[model samples]
Target: MEPNDQPAPLLEGRFEGRNDFIQLVRDALGVAAQAGWRELILSDSNFYDWPLGERAVIDSLNAWARGGRQLTLLAKSYDEVVRRHPRFVAWRATWGHIIQCRACPNADALDVPSMIWSSDWVMQRLDPVRSVGVAGTEAGRRVAARELLREWIENKSAPGFASTTLGL
Candidate 1:
């Protein structure tokens, strides 16, 4: 590994496609609960297949929230699910944090306040001076985070809500 190659501390954005998103959401829930991840930054692509994604996303959020962690959604704007889903909307209104990505169009009308993930949030949170020096060695944090998430999925006590399909 190059001395300068390091994994960045990520607050990732993902699209919903097939089972990958499902797995990711499940893993993210575990990571948030076990590793102290504070926010989940999402992109507009998250809405591509609305219902499945919503089911997975909402379940994950509820699971994490019930376990006492926070969820932050970055949105293009308000949509039916965000506006009508009793659980998510309530969370956003009272418990969850939101960030609007205005560049995504229609994001300004989102009903919640959200921090921009790419430019403002991660940049500010990651210490460039410190990370630059130890970027290569600091990757252990990411590996550990992934392991914690995987552990949660394997634990039957915290099994994520089942998807209708076989999760095949």
Candidate 2:
């Protein structure tokens, strides 16, 4: 078979409302999972709530992690995430090794939006309360987004969550 060089179409949009945003995230995650993504990096303060409320998303994440993919989360405040979404605490307890979390002390400077990125795709949530954001699968966009995430993680001195301290 000949090589296929055409670039994947951009998967971009603005979602309105929590359900829509959740669905958008679900779709994005599903694509990444199906594509056999090796790693996922997420930067969000309130992401715990989304997965806690959406069982399918949680299931998908668990399944993805079980398949040996790494899921890293960089959050502004772990206490806040757990406080708002206690279910996450429980979930993390079960999948702590696979779904690792890090603390970002200077999350404000990295403020484009909350985002989830894999090697092949990127999803960003622009508005926290309104659930408005964009997602794309273009290689350039994914690379740029992934670079931004890497830089943010490196610059902020993000630290991995300690299960002993966090009681996870």
Best by lDDT: 2
Task: Tell me the lDDT of model 2 at 89.
Answer: 65
TM-score of each: 0.38, 0.76
Per-residue alpha-carbon lDDT of model 1 for 31-105, expressed as tens digits? 443444455443231232233235555555554455444333433433544445546555444443332222233
Candidate 1 residue pairs in clash (backbone atoms < 3 Å): 76-107, 98-114, 99-114, 99-115
Once fitted onto the true fold, the runs of candidate 1 whose alpha carbons sit more than 4 angstroms away are 1-17, 45-71, 96-103, 106-168
Model 1: lDDT to the true structure: 0.34
Measured by TM-score, how close is model 1 to the native structure? 0.38
